[model samples]
Target: MKNKFVQILVTGILVASLPACKQRPDNDAARAKGTGAPTIASTLHFADEHTTATYETAINKFFKNGLFRSGFNGSYLVAKEGKIIAEGYNGFLDPVTKTDSIGEHDAFHLASVSKTFTGMAVLKLWEEGKIGLDDDLSKYFDKFPYPGTTVKMLLSHRSGLPNYTNYLEHYNWDKKKLVTNLDVLTSLYTMHPPLQFPTGKRFSYCNTNYALLALLIEKVSGKAYHVYLEETFFKPLGMTDTYVFSLDKAETAMPSFEWNNRRYGLEFMDLVYGDKNIYSTVRDMLKWDEGLRNGNLFRQSTLDSAFQGYSYEKAGARNYGLGWRLTEVENGKKIVYHNGWWHGNNTVFIRLLEEKATIIVLGNKYNRGIYRSKQLCDIFGDYRQSNKTFQELENESSNGLAAGGSQ
Candidate 1:
C-alpha cells in the first residue's frame, strides 16, 4: 500500500513538471540523445505579442499593396517558431477562366527551389556512408568524362560544368519530346565541350551539377530519382500533396503566367528532375522547412554542411552551399535560402536561422517582385540583402536560364 502511494506521488510530480520541462532550451547534447542522432539546437526566439503585431502590419502594408501593383500572383507564408504569422494569396489557378483563385491547397512548381530537396537527399545518403562527399563521378559512372570532379564540388557549384541548354542549339534533338537526365549526360560525355571554368575553380551555378547528382542518386540507390524522394522524404513526412511533376499530369497540371497574364504552356524540358520539376503547396513547404529544422531526416552535421559556404575566394557577401544559396552578414548571422524560376514561376524560400523564421513566396506568374520576399527578414533582424543575386538572376531568367539554370 505504501509503495503504491509512492508510485502515485511520483507520477503526479512527473505530470506536473511536463509543461515546464518542454519550455526549457534544447541544447545540442539533449537533442542528440533525445533523437538518437545529431539534431539542431533550437535558436527559436519567439516574437512577443507586440513584435508579432508589428511584423503582421508591416507584411500586409508592404507586400499586399506593393505586390499587387507590381503584378505579383501566388501564395506567400511568413512563419516563426513553426507558427504562421502572416499569409496571403492573390492569383488565379486557371488564368483563362479566371475563376479558380489561388488558395492554400494549390501547389506551385518549385523550379530551382527543388535543388534544396536534392541536396538534402544527397546528404542523407552521405550520412549513411553509402556515398562519400569527396567521391569522384568516375566511381559511379565509369564513362563519366570529368575525372577529378568530386561529389562535394558538384554540391557546392564548384564543378565548373557547362550548362547543357547551351548545346541544345548545336545538338540535333526532338523539341516536342522531353529530354531525360541521361540524354543530357550522353551529350556532355560525347561532345566533351569546354567547361565554363576549370574543375574546382570558382562558383558558377549550373543545372548540370544537380542533373548529374540525380543520376548519381539513381546509380547508388538502384531506384529512380523520383521514387527515392517519395519513399525517403515525402511519404514519411506526410507530404501527401507534394510530388515530382509527371508528364501524364502535364495536360491537367497548373499553368504558369506572365505579368501581362499570358499563359506559358508545358514544354519538353519539364521532364527533368534535379534542378526543377518539384510541385508543392505553401503549407507542405513549411512542413519541409520544419523537418529540416527539427532534423527529422539528416544529421545536424550533414545539414550544417549544406549551409556552409565553400567558395570564399569569390567577391561577395553571397556564397553557394551544397544546394542552397547563403549570405553571411558581418554580424555572423547567416541567411540560408534558395529561389526558383521556371516558365512563369518565380519563388523564394528564405530560412532565418537565429530568428527561427521562414519566408516562402511562390508565384506562378512572372514577376520579379517575389524576390523582395527577402525584405521580410528585416523584421527579424538586420539582414543584408543580396541585391546582385536578385538582379542578375532576374535578368538572366529573361533568357530562360534562372540562377539555378534550367539547363
Candidate 2:
C-alpha cells in the first residue's frame, strides 16, 4: 500500500524574528478585535535544516518499519515548532483493489477524536457567557434523568451517565431506526437507565456525556450542533476538509473497512454526531492544533481548563481532561492526546504540549498499529525513559491492555 510518499521539509535557515505561536498567551480581546473569527497561523517557525532532516528521516523510518508494514491505509502528518516536517498518504480509497490513491485532501472518520471538537465548542459557549460549566443538565433538558450532572462533569467524563451505545444495544433499540443526538437524549429520559456511578464520584468515559452536550449546544445556541461547528470553527480555521458527518453527506465521505478488507455497513447507531462522526484530513487537523495554540478559538484560561485533569480517584499516568487524554510522563511533561475507534476507522490525534509537536494518524481500515503511533513521541522529546519500552507499550495497547479508558 506504500505506493506514494510525500515528504516536505521547510528549506530555510532559522528566522529569528518569527514569533513562536506556542509561547503566546491566549488573548480573547485580541481575537475579538478582528472579525471575531479564528485565523489559521500564517507564519510558522521552521526548524533548522538539520533538525528538519533528522525528524523527516526518523518519521519515514517509523512509518516504513511500523505503520505501513502493518497495512496502514490512511494519512499521517508530523509537525515540529509549527512547521510540517513530514507527512504522507498511502493505500487506496477502495481497500480491496489498489485503484485511486489516497491524497492529502481525503477525510477519514475521526471517531472518538470528535469529542475534542464537541468539548471545545461547549467551552467556547461557556467563554461567551452563553452557558455555565457548572450548570446542571436539568437546567437545559427538563427531563434529564441525572439531576446534578453539570457541563463540567460531562466534559471531564465524570457525568456517571451510562454509555448510550451499551444501553441502546442491550435494551433492544430498533435496529432499523437510525439514532440521532435527540434520540439518545430521549432514551435517557424515557428509559431512565441507572447512572454508572454517582455524579462526579469517579471518571467514566461515556459517549452519552458528549451526546447530551450536543443537545445543550443546540438549545443554547439555537443552532444544530453540526451547523454551529461548521460556522464557528471549521470555516474560521480554514479547515475546509473537516466537518461533522451526516447521512446526507454519506456518499462523499470516505468509507471504512474491516481489517480483512470487508466494508462496514451503516447500522442503527451510525447517525450520531457528538460522540463520533467527525470527518477530517491530517492537514485540517493540524490547522485545528494551530488554531487552539494561537488563541484564536479559545482563551488560554479555557484551554487550561480543558487540559486540566479532573478525576484523581485512581493513581496512574492516565487522566481525562475536559475533552483530551493526558499522560503526565517523566520530567513533568504532559502529552495531550485522543485516540478513536469506530467501526473500522482507527485514528490518533496527539499533541506534545510543551514540545510544540503534533502527531496525527487517520486510517479507515482497522489497524491496531495506529495506536502505537504514540511511541513516535520519543523522536521529539524525552518520553522513552519510562519502565516500559515503546515496543512493550505498543504491545500492551494493541492487545487491549490500554483499551479500558480509550475511546
Candidate 3:
C-alpha cells in the first residue's frame, strides 16, 4: 500500500544503490510499523521502448512493490549464455567498510533448499549401489518404522509423511535433538497419526520426508550427511564453499543484503545469513544448473524416471520428480523447479528446458512466497532486452574482505 508519488526517487540509479541513500520518503506511519527493522530500496523498471527486458515488466513491478522490503539478507545472479547478466546484494551491508564490504559473504541457512544438495547426494549414492529408489524405508532405519514407504515415495514426497518434526518445535528439545533428520522422524509417533492420505496417494511438501531420507542416506552410504555432501557434491562440483550447516564457517560470513522500499520505508530481506548454514555463491549454483544439463549424474533412462512423475494423481498429488518438481506443457515450455523454505529463508531453483536457462534466488528473509515467485518466473520466461532507460545497480562496497571469494 505505498503511494506512487514520491517513490520516483528510486528511479535513475542502480537498483542496488538504494540502501546507501536510505531516507524514509516522508512517510510517518509506515516507518513506525517497521521501525528499527532493516530496509532495502529496489525497483526494476523496464522501458516501453525496448523488448528484450520488456518481458520483465511483471518482475519489474514486483521489485517496485517492496518485495525487496522483507528479507534477512539476499543475493541474486541472473545468467545467460554463460555470463552473469544481473547480480545484486541488499541489506545488512557495512555502510562505511571496504569497497567490498561485509555484505559480500553473509552465509544463510539453506533450510529445505538443503534438500537439493541432499537429493543430489542421494542420487550419487544410488550410483554407487548404496540405495535404490524403490527400496522401502523400513529397511534402512529401525527406530521408527513405516513398512510401506519406499525411497522413491520419500523423494517424490509421496511417502504420506506429514512433516512431524514441526510438532517438536512446539516442545523444548535440547539442541542435541532438534531439527535433525532423526529427531524429526522420532517425533512422527507423537504427531497426531500416520499420513493424512495413503502412500503414493498425494503430494504435499513434507519436510519429514527429507529428514528421513537423510537418515536413509547415512544408513546406506555409511557416511554422515554433511561429510558426504562435502565429498561428493561440494568437492567434485567445485562448489567447495557450500555446506549443510557449518558453524565455524559462519564467522566469516558475507554481510547480509536487503532492499529499501524507498517511498514506504519498507525493508525487504532477500538472503539468509547465519553462523551454522548452507554456504554458496552464484558461480557455484551456475555450475549446478549447467551440470544438470550436460552431465550424466543419473543415467539417461534414469534421468527421465527421476524427473518424471512416478504416478498420476490429482489434488495434492501434483507434478513432481525423484528429487525435483516437474511440469509438462501442452504447447509451452515444461519446467522443473522446487523451492526451499525454512524459518525466514527462501530459495527458488528453476530450470526451463525450452529457454535453456535457470533462475535461482536465495534470500534470508521470508513471506514473499507465491506472488514474488510467480513474478520471477515471468521475468525468466518472458524478459525482453531493454537498455534504453534501464539502469543497472552497482555495488558501492569496495572494502569487502572477500569481494571476489569464490563460494
Candidate 4:
C-alpha cells in the first residue's frame, strides 16, 4: 500500500508539472505582442530551453525520491530565469473534510517568509523618504519600550529586542480575542520584559522586530498593514493570490495541519503581522522574487543593502539581512533565502542570484522534507558540486531546518 501511494504521488506531481493541454488567450496575446516575455503564468526566463528541460527532469526526480517517497504534502515550484521549469502541488487542504485537495492556485500561510514583504515595505518607505532606517522606534511609537532600536535594526534582526511571542506565551492574555500589534507593543511597555541583549549587540532573530515594523508601516503609511502591502506590493506586482491574513477570515482561508492530520489551531498571536500571517501561492511568490532580482520594486542600492550581511561578528557563513537570510557560499555568491514554520506550515524559499534560480516549497501538513527543497539548488549551478560547498550548505541547512515555528 505504501509503495502504491508513492507511485500515485509521483504520477500526480509529473502531471502537475506538465504543460496545460490548451494554451490560454493571454498566452496567445503575449506571444503576439512579440516582446518574447512569457505570460505571468508561463514566465520562463531561462537562457536555453533544452537546459531548462534537463534541469526540470532532475528536479522532478529529486522530488519523486525525496518528497514523494517520504509522504511530503504541499506545493513545490522550481523556476529558472523567468520561466518555471517544474512545479506541482500535493495533499489535502483540509484533512478532516478531505474534500478539497491542494491545487496550483491554493495559498499557504507563508509563516516567517512574510518577513520578506515586510522588510521590502520598510525599504520602499525608506526609499520614498517617508521614513529613515536609522530613525528610532520612538519616532513612530511614542511608548516603544526600547529607545535605541531603529528600523534598520528591526529589518536586519540586530535590535536585540525580545520576541513578543515568547512574552505572550507566559502572559495571561485572553486567547479568545485576537491580539493586535498594538497589544504587543503595549505588553512590552506594561510588562517591561528585559531585552535579550542591548541594541546593536549582535544578530538575534526576534519576531518582535517585525511586529514593530508592521506598526511602523501603519504609522508611516497611514494605512492598515494589509492594505498597504496590497496597494504597494501585491496589486502592483500582479500577486493576486497573496494577502496578509486576518482572524475574521480564518474560516475562509486555507487551513494548516500537523503530521497526524490534526488541524493547527489559531491563538491570540495570529493577529500580529510582519513576523508572519501572509498567505500566498507559489506563482505570486515568484513574481516577488523576480521583482526583487530585476530592480522593479526598489533601487539597485536598496537591494544591495538588503542582501549584504549586517553582522560580521557572527562566526558562521550565515547572516541575517533586511528580510532575507544571507548564506555566503563559495566564490562570494550569496544565497538569499528564508524558511518559515508557523502552525503546521513549513516553507523554504531560496533565491540563487547568480544562477537566477528559485526554489520554493510550502507544506501545510508538517513535513520536514520541505526544507530539502534547498538541495534543488545543487542542480542549478556548480555551487553544490564541491565537498566543501556541500558541507557548508549542509551545516546551514541544519540550523534552518531546526528553527522553530515562530521563526
> Largest lDDT belongs to which candidate?
2
Q: What is the lDDT ranking, best to worst? A: 2, 4, 1, 3
lDDT, residue 339, model 2? 98
| TM-scores, each model vs. reference | 0.81, 0.84, 0.67, 0.84
lDDT for 209 in candidate 3 is: 73
Model 2: lowest-lDDT 10 consecutive positions? 16-25
Better of 1 and 2 by lDDT: 2
Q: Cα lDDT for residue 118, model 1?
A: 90
Q: Between prediction 1 and prediction 3, which has the larger TM-score?
A: 1
Write model 1 residue lDDT over 163-254, tens digit each, in one string: 77666546666787788898878878777778888899888888888988999999888898999999988888778778888888787667
TM-score for candidate 1, residues paired by index: 0.81
What is the lDDT for 249 in model 4? 77
Q: Per-prediction RMSD in angstroms? A: 15.2, 10.6, 11.0, 8.6
Q: How high is the lDDT of residue 180 in model 2?
A: 90
Q: In candidate 3, what are the lDDT values of residues 181-241, reduced to their tens digit?
A: 5546666655545565777777776766766777777777777777776776677676755
Off by over 4 Å in 1: 1-51, 386-407
The weakest ten consecutive residues by lDDT in model 1 span: 1-10
lDDT of 4 by residue, 111-168 (tens): 9999999999999999999999999888888857788988999999999888878877
